[model samples]
Target chain A: MKDPMIDIRNLSVTFNRGRKPVKAVNGVSLSVNSGEVVALLGESGSGKSVTMRSLLRLHPKGTSIEGSMRVAGNDVTELSARELADYRGATVSMVFQEPRLALDPVYTLGQQIEEAIMRHENVSRREAALRALGLFEKVRIPSPERRLMNYPHEMSGGMLQRSMIAMAIACNPKVLLADEPTTALDATVQIQILLLIRELQKEYGLSVIFVTHDIGVAAEVADRIAVMYAGRIVEEGKVADVIQNPKHPYTRGLLGARVELAHGRDRLITIPGAPPDLAALPPGCAFAPRCAEAAAQCITDVPRLTAIDDTASVACVRYA
Target chain B: MINLVGEPSPILPVGERGGPAQPLISVRGLLKHFPVKGSGFLKPKKVVHAVDGVDFDILKGETLGVVGESGCGKSTTARLLMQLITPDRGEILFDGESAGETLPLSEYRRQVQMVFQDSYASLNPRLTIEESIAFAPRVHGVPAAKAIARAHDLLHRVGLEPVRFAGRYPHELSGGQRQRVNIARALALEPRLVILDEAVSALDKSVEAQVLNLLLDLKRDFGLTYLFISHDLNVVRFMCERVMVMYLGKVAEIGERDAIFEKTRHPYSSALLASMPKMNPGERTLEPPLSGDPPNPIDPPAGCRFHTRCSFAEDVCRQTLPPLSRISGAQSAACLMAMTNSGHSRAPVQMEA
Candidate 1:
């Protein structure tokens, strides 16, 4: 509890390309202690996924990352190719949005999972196979033994996601990074997956960084939420505190526009315009264009994230 | 033929042709079964029961929401209504006139339009926003100049300024903008019944709210009825006046939005409602309301398709397929417990109470 398991400090990632580089992650600093789950909430182009992907050092060549990213006591940016390979699945694992694309179609699910296990540790094929079945049962895959032989195409979306979860925890990873795991599934099935992830996170006492765009989902899963807007963290707080009394104007707009919250109202109180383009975002606050409370200062000077209390922070001129 | 009364009071099936309270579109025993591949040559032909024995009434000037899992045939039902696919059996009556028989197919089609989920694929890349909207109207005997004029008018109505967006191609616009253009195109023919199949499911939170409000305005101004299909329960509840819950191509429950959302009768409906993420962090869902994926639709469970997953399912539920019958004032459910005499051991006792 003294030090966070995953600490990202003053990180800035830029895509090195034509003319000006695309600044994807700008001065993002977040920390997750052991067994704590923090949801990085943002709409598209907000760079939530990019920040999570940085922990694994998965960015393409020519991309430059500044500042420190420490996961499981290892400096992620300084890790070599061989060290990164060993650190990835054993120390931290990821559950991607689309399991169909994340999983290999050519091999059986059993083969893929067993291969990952054996690569991480010195285990025999038979032992790895047994461990795979155990992981499958933990994730509640029906008829685990038979399902192990089925290809990725044979399973439903929810089933495939369960298999993905099973594979993710195959190595007993310390941290699990889930990027929109339940976005594609049906509502009935989505709840099941969310519950399973929560249950697994508890049983394993794993630190988690869940990236999602849906606020309801963030509330349901994460202990803390970091709201991102145009490559910047606009607000960070406990899920209840942020939801009950949102500090930032953008977070307030998000909660107000939720259809469930607008139950009795005839017309939804929508934020006027769309999210700003990340590549060519204007100066000052990116959300100032659509923010109802954007003052004259909000249009000229960018607001820094200022802490309001022990568990809450907001990045707006009014709060700053 | 618009119903001036916005309230969706249950208009029971009009047994005769010229009943006073005729529904805009009435579907009876709608069935469509797609055969599984490589099932031939002396083998028993396997069929995926995409839609079977479904019946509903889309009331005039009201949004009827259809919700289900991916393979529950919600989209199949919409396609059947649009004549995009031919059904194996059943009949669809438009204003008491048998569709394609008394009422010409083209005339029936002209009054109905559909907006799909993928905003980009629905429109052509080469055509500008004005041309895409004008194409549909031009196809139905409208002159070139008049169709283009109508298109510009529709773009303005859908909140896209014609002066700025009329000439832009589909690729040049954002996802929200493309969806607005698609909505404009759907309204170009002045469609009376618009089927929105996950239309706002792709947009962001703020954009979805804006589009939903726009949809309400259009519906009120045009006096249009909507058959809205979606997987998101929250969005469905907000947009729809009446809601229908389908499970494996069968109507588990259908009723007024309040009754379905509040006084839910079917086990499946309750499970679905419970699964919606409560927007508050204080009251987080402890247990998953339902577990396991939907059973294979190719060979659905015997009798009641939902019995395998239903918590209160009994032997009788496994043996007998319960009929969808009205239980409350405006709510109907196709569950053994809801059927007063459905011999599910607990039905009669509950019914008496």
Candidate 2:
């Protein structure tokens, strides 16, 4: 098989290392092959965003990261400051949730896209501007020329997100990191954006690590889904298998809780308790307190991500 | 405007006291327009038609879900029902009396409470959870001690133990907990109708489910009516008995949940339903149901508000506004195609095929 475009091994990231540290991501290992889409599904504070940000090394200065992250054949953890700057946006790019906040308010989208291109590539200003227009057209933004001159705020939320996607793929990165890109968009516009991302990913053969809390969206776009609970990946499998036959209690609860258009269930099955506090997580399984299938052993021993079948792996004492 | 001294009082009898079986709240021809600031003093100021010619009825003890994209005036309609903003035109009839005419604004507001999307912003940081919930009742002339006791009961009802959480400030709670507190506060007034404006949108799926179940239980126990406004179609479908779909400050469709979801007639409603990302990976959306955003509210299309992005737009659709017409039992849509069956068939059948 071809080498994985992005390989993360035993990745652990903690904030405020010495005093009152928060282990945001604990022992997460993920691999994304070229042209594949892996979704990291979790609620707030489940370390889905933190795990993705580690790929770009975008965490705050005090964050202590202990992990092996190799993206596009480069050790992300060992990159120097100069190399790191070059790595971002060129090797790996990200599309954030709120494009209005991510984009520069003062600059026209054209200048920003041109800047991104000129910063990384040895292209003239005019050539970069031309490329930016082409990128806009590629993303199917209407009137690409006029849209290029428009400021971010002038465009609607969906349009701004499309421009953001256009900017993210300007450098033709190998791996794309999208953190809830469609969460802020309206429903009709959200489908357009999701389809655009999927189309661009296939066109470029980019490995995508899409992070979202919506299982429906993950199912729509992801090839594989990794369910995270309290900073740990409790389940990882092909989207169909995970949705059809979920092994982990948390995954099952999430599926049951999902409000589907087809199903008219009276009450959604809720996971009893909130996610554990990362700073003071419970020993053993982080989800044990909320897991209905949790046993006495679940409280005392951490469950490793063991392969349940050729297509799936689950980190649960029940599975063990 | 002369009044006779012997005229009977304008106030209608309260809550099914010998009155006909009328909806609890009825809105007709509601319109709210805000003037935009022009570049210069001489430039003709444009107007943003935030809520333009919207009409609906909310029966007592029924949950009516309003689903629409942002800027579709769903929030504006909610605020209008709460009487937080005055309408430019149209009347709001509450309990068989025109609100602000026979019925006073204060009484209208008392009967209709609102819970906003941002729980943190809606709550006071300095106030404890109990104090926040108790504030409304206390101001409405309930005794302090009784209000406090009621707040404690409400907190317990929302699954946050009053003994542990009552004394804690808003900042001390998580997003879901803060939202529960917000819900409790909305219920403090014993309102007949509660406007939930994206209340669960900010919560996680698990917590959202818990809150939705709690809301259902509260609705049943208290006999409360709800105006559930959200962009999440699934949640709206699950929580609402009846649903209203809006497009650019106008009612696109309104009907029973099953009628709206299963046999939708409006092109816009069908497109919106088709746009929902499917849970099955094997079934992908073949095409984007609708392209581009809704047209700017300031300069909405002359005919159908949705024609700009609608795939079934015909020449007539761009020239003449379509009045909402009933398609089947309790299901109504304001689409030229659905009304006449002339252009393309409704968006759902076309998309499915």
Candidate 3:
């Protein structure tokens, strides 16, 4: 399929900071082809962010990671410290949830963009500054020159996020990892940012992995949607198919919970319990406790992600 | 003076309460401005026009939604109603009596309670969930035992089993569970008006629905009024009977939920409605409904605050601020286009369009 831009196979991430070793991401397999936008959809503690962070190796020391991740031809897990540093922004870039906290307070937005450009390419300070201005223009930020000169706090939430996107794309990375980039902004500002990101992704032919908890956001941005449960991808398919016809019990419950203003919300179909703890996950399906149609097998054995068609899969016994 | 451009009617939809329902709270000319630091001596003193010239009435037993962007003064309005911050110029009337004079601020505050967005920061780490919920009632001289009983009853009503959860610390519960505790605490005072300022915004969609349903139930069971403030439009649409759309400290629109959502009059309200993410993938939004961030609230535009980003702006819009004028049965908009004879070329046609 023309070499997937970002490919991950049976990836698992474990955090050792606490007393117990928490397996945050357990055997997640995802791939995004060139110019494709795949959304990692999940609620809090679903390990969607943990899976995405593994792509950039953003986890801390003593965190154990297994399985293989390939992004723009560099083996992410096997990269040496020096190679990893060189490979980070130029090969793949990330946009975080809170741009205000993600950015350095003291440095002006211009300095940050310029630094990113200079780090990746052999460019002079003036060229980098010009490039930063170009990026601002590309992102449709008004008064680009003045805005670049403003510090992080000086800019509003939407403007700060636009600048963050500018920095993320300054290196012209093939893969873009946006981790709930619009979650903190207002709805109007969020749509503006989403359109900007989509436009930029198209112009650059960037393979993007967008992570968010909001289903509507996933529908708007993603070509393919992967529904994550406790540390595992329970369902994956074409965005429309997954959203319109969720197969797994967890996926169905999530879709059923989607209450729009247009629909008459009599009652939201809630998944009766919370996400399982990463440190103390039960045997079998992690979603078993909350799944309405959970069979006895769901509590006895973990279901594998079984493919239904070319682009559809569900990790449930019913689907199998 | 911020008077109505046209003769004011009951712009809001009639409350569910029949026969000339008394408003629980009436906030008139509410204004709160914070001074920007480091603007002394050399430069002109600049203040953020946070809650400038805001006016709205929360009718008894109804959920009046306050919706706007981050700096749009929805939160500020909530704080003003809760009496958490004093306004520079305004009068808050509780049941036709001026608070701090006839009604008394303490009594007014006792009838009103607030639940903030951050569930963790709002709760006391040292106290158990039951303690947190009972604190408000005990302070109001409800007696310790009665307050604790009330707390347990509220916890049960909010779907948290008191037997298992009452003794647990804030850290021991999930985010959804913690928020339930916050709700229980807000209700402990037996307040008439509860200001839920983004109370469910941080929650996951499934859990948010649960909380929303719970709020509706509590409102019905306790006969409480809610100032449901949120940036999320879908939740607001489902939860609120009437809505007030604010922009840069001004009421952009206020109306019945159906009228505002279906027959939107104000351009800003239309944009806000259009900004909600579509459920169907086939109908995903192609372009942003509104461009640019909500203009800097500090030193706001002289006339219309939203004129800079508004697509239908004209010189007249820049020259004079349009006050809220009733364009429909249940909707009022502060846009010249919606105000007939407001001097805008499209005002006459804009009313019917």
Estimate, for each residue in A1-320, the C-alpha lDDT of model 2 and write its tens digit.
88899999999999996668999999999899989999999999999999999999999898899979999999999999999999999999999999999999999999999999999999999999999999999999999999999999899999999999999999989989999999998989999999998998888999999999988889889999999988889999999999888989988888878777225667777789898888998988898888777789999888999998876999987778
- Each candidate: chain B TM-score: 0.92, 0.91, 0.92
Score candidate 1 by DockQ: 0.77
lDDT, candidate 1, B103-204, per-residue tens: 888887877799999999999999998999999878899999999999989999989899999999999999999999999898887777899999999998
Off by over 4 Å in 2: A17-19, A261-264, B1-20, B340-353
TM-score of candidate 1 relative to the true fold: 0.95
Determine the backbone clash count of candidate 1.
0
lDDT of 2: 0.90
Q: Which numbered prediction scores highest in DockQ against the true structure?
A: 1
TM-score of 3: 0.95
User: Candidate 2, after superposition: displacement of residue B88 in Å?
Assistant: 0.4
The C-alpha stretches of model 1 lying farther than 4 A from their native spots are A16-20, B1-20, B349-353
Computed on C-alphas against the true complex, the DockQ of each candidate is 0.77, 0.68, 0.68
Model 1 clash pairs? Answer: none
Sorting all predicted structures by lDDT, with the top scorer first, yields: 1, 2, 3
